[model samples]
Target: MLEVNHISLTFNEGTPDEKKALQHIQLKLNKGDFVTVIGSNGAGKSTLMNIISGALFPDVGKVTINEKNVTLLQEFKRSNYIGRVFQDPMAGTSPTMTIEENLAMAYSRNKKRTLKLGVNKNRRAFFKSALATLHLGLEQRLNAKVGLLSGGERQALSLLMATFTEPDILLLDEHTAALDPSRAALITNLTKEVVEKTGLTTLMVTHNMQQALDLGNRLIMMDKGQIILDISGAEKQALTIEKLLHEFQRIRGEQMGDDRAILG
Candidate 1:
């Protein structure tokens, strides 16, 4: 359960390069709701995610999670309630750390540190079981440096690590965009499985129109720092890529048939 109320953010205000990245944006995601966000570059998609995850504070308005106000909470302080997987596989993981070590750190998040780096047998067993669920054979390579993993593997592990404790909200920022098509699909399916299995409330930003439509219970389209379209239930069920493209063109009053490069 997350509520973003009357949120707005701007960069370089009162300057020549001033820009309003989000304009009075408001969004509500119920518990277990998986919302897919799609927008062209500079449409405030990632900005919204950042605001929710506490990476950026809104110049106006508040963010509430599970009825607790976190608008002023620092990013690191929100880790107990928020989980995030970034666009870059390398961003969420330490390249030099071993797989189990990475997972151990995630597992130890929000807990009292004991100055002990060695993994206890029980924790190691849990990490192995968790990695096994990825089905990427990472369980066998718990001691291997994460840098040796492929991009997709690292991203998958990132997903697992982020959701290990089932935070109140999951923020996925174009997480699969860097992987190849096959790996992207793999991560996509894995995302759905993990979220559904854990009943994790999720907000995922994606550029691919088909992927946006094919996943999530609700879909939102944003442009020029505002939500232009919000579709769900029967409306989202009846929507198609062609209609979505048409609506985007109509709302922006521009030619988009050739803008697939920017949108997707």
Candidate 2:
């Protein structure tokens, strides 16, 4: 349901600090396809996500969702159909807003605004039900300011908010990277559960190799602003971490140098 065609982006062009962020990147995701992206730092994983989400427009090529070209659409406009959770738990949520208020804003996404109050009796019930799915007891803290929550709780809430409406495409940019192991595991399980239940088309960038192998139907490896490897189906299923590392070394002719990716 999403297509990125020959997309390329550069920063500080024609200057001493100019660097190519993405080069001729082409990707396609069918409806309900969950693709996991893995790479070292500066590999253009987040750059690709930003381009797809409309936070950055590629200098070349186009992005199409459900046959509609959205290459130049503004970020807020794309929010109607694109759901994203950032690396930082704090990025997705407003520290000042209460739990229910944050959820209420997410619930109102893509819907025409009106004079009606944002949160009501029925909406509260719905928000409570949704929060209950996170199993974080946030349903009991609907009025609590989000800043009061722990990192894991806030990340869980962010995940819930992003998927609340089942947007056409979901972008997860190393979302669990900031959490401890246990909390990361919790969010990972929740991600799998929500995506399976909703059948949302997803692109998740992660430094964790095991997570990339375990979660998605397809796997992509990027380096130096280009996709170096794309594997799926039985090939992806049969892949192991050792083999993946070997493949990276083989294709790129250099060992993967990012310790975080290797150790994750």
Candidate 3:
């Protein structure tokens, strides 16, 4: 459902201190494809997602959603096609808004807003059902401010809001990176569950090796702004973290540098 073609972005080009984030990167995701992206720091993982989400426009190349070219689309213009959850729990939702209010905004995203009440009987019923699926007792706390939630709770709510409309593409920028092991696992499980239920095409950048292997149907490794490896189906199912590390070191001709990825 998403296609990125020969996209490249460079910062401070033609000057000292220039950095290239994406090096003509190309990725195509099919409908309902769940792709997990892994890489060391500065591997263009986040940059790729930003280009897809229109958070950062590529100096060259194009982005398409459902065959509609969005390369020239501004960030706000592309919001209708993308749903993003950042690493920071506080980035996605309004701290002052209640759980239901935040959901109301999500419900209205990419559409004209109305002067009617924020939550009517039908919307409350839908909200309650959606919140109940989080299994966090948030359905009963619709009036609770989102700021009152824990890190995991807030991130979980953020995930819900991102998928409330089931955008054509879901971009997850290490959405669970800030949580502890237990909470991270919880959020990760919720993420998979929500994606499977909604059948949304997803791109997730994660450092946790096991979670990467366990969650997505396709696995890819990136280095120097290019995809180094892409595996799927039987091949991906049989791959282990140790083997992945070995492959990385062999391909890059250096030790894999992500200690967090190794430790996890």
Candidate 4:
């Protein structure tokens, strides 16, 4: 339901520090498609996400969602169709708001705000029921401030908030990167569950190789602002971490430099 066509971007254009973050990048994602993006530092992974989310506009070409061109749309305007969970738990949530309050706000994200902002009994029950699916016992903490939660708990709640409305597309920008191994795994599994349940088209940028492989139906590897490898179906099914690393070495004709991706 998303199409990125012939898009290109450069930073500090015509200056000494000028760098091309993306170049003639093209991608099309169908409804319910889940794509995992992988790359080393400065590989344009986050740049691509930003462009799609309207946080950055491409210097060339267009971004379309559901056949509507949104290349010139503002970030807030595009929030109606996009749900995102950032790398930092603190970024996606309001620290002072209670869990249910935060959820209430997210639920109203794309809707017209009414004069009444308070959560009523039915909305509170809905929030509790939704939080219960995380299986983190957060349903009992509806009134607890989100700041009181642990990193994993906050991230889990953030995930819940993002998917609560089932936005047309979900962007996960290394969402579990800041958590410990155990919490990362938990969030990863939860991500899969939520995506499957909602059938939300998704693009996830991850430094973790295993995570890239283990989730999503399509895998994209980018380098130097271009997509170097795109694997899916049978090719993706046969993929392994060792083979992926070898392929990277083959493509670059040099040792892969991102140690976090290699070690992950």
Query: Per-residue error at 250 for model 1, in Å?
Result: 3.0
Output the TM-score of candidate 3: 0.98
lDDT of 1 by residue, 1-264 (tens): 899999999999999999999999989999999999998888899999999999899999999999999999999889889889999999999999999999988887667768886588998998899888899999999999999999999999999999997888999999999999999999999998999899999999998888888888999998879999999987888889889888888888885533653456
The TM-score values for the models, in the order shown, are 0.96, 0.99, 0.98, 0.98
From the highest TM-score down, the ranking of the candidates is 2, 4, 3, 1
Ranking by lDDT: 2, 4, 3, 1
Better of 2 and 3 by TM-score: 2
Candidate 2 runs further than 4 Å off: none
lDDT values, one for every candidate: 0.90, 0.95, 0.92, 0.95
Candidate 4 C-alpha lDDT tens digits along 77-142: 999999999999899899999998899999997898898965899899899899999999999989
TM-score of 1: 0.96
Superior candidate under lDDT, 1 versus 4: 4
Q: State the lDDT of candidate 3 residue by residue for 42-89, as single tens digits.
A: 999999988888878899998999999999899888989888899999
Candidate 2 lDDT tens digits, 86-132:
99999999999999999989887889878899999999999999999
State how far residue 103 of model 3 sits from its true place (Å): 0.4
Off by over 4 Å in 4: none
- Note each model's CA RMSD in angstroms: 1.5, 0.7, 0.9, 0.8
Q: For model 3, what is the error of residue 55's alpha carbon versus the real structure, in angstroms, after optimal superposition?
A: 0.8
Model 2: how far residue 41 lies from native, Å:
0.3
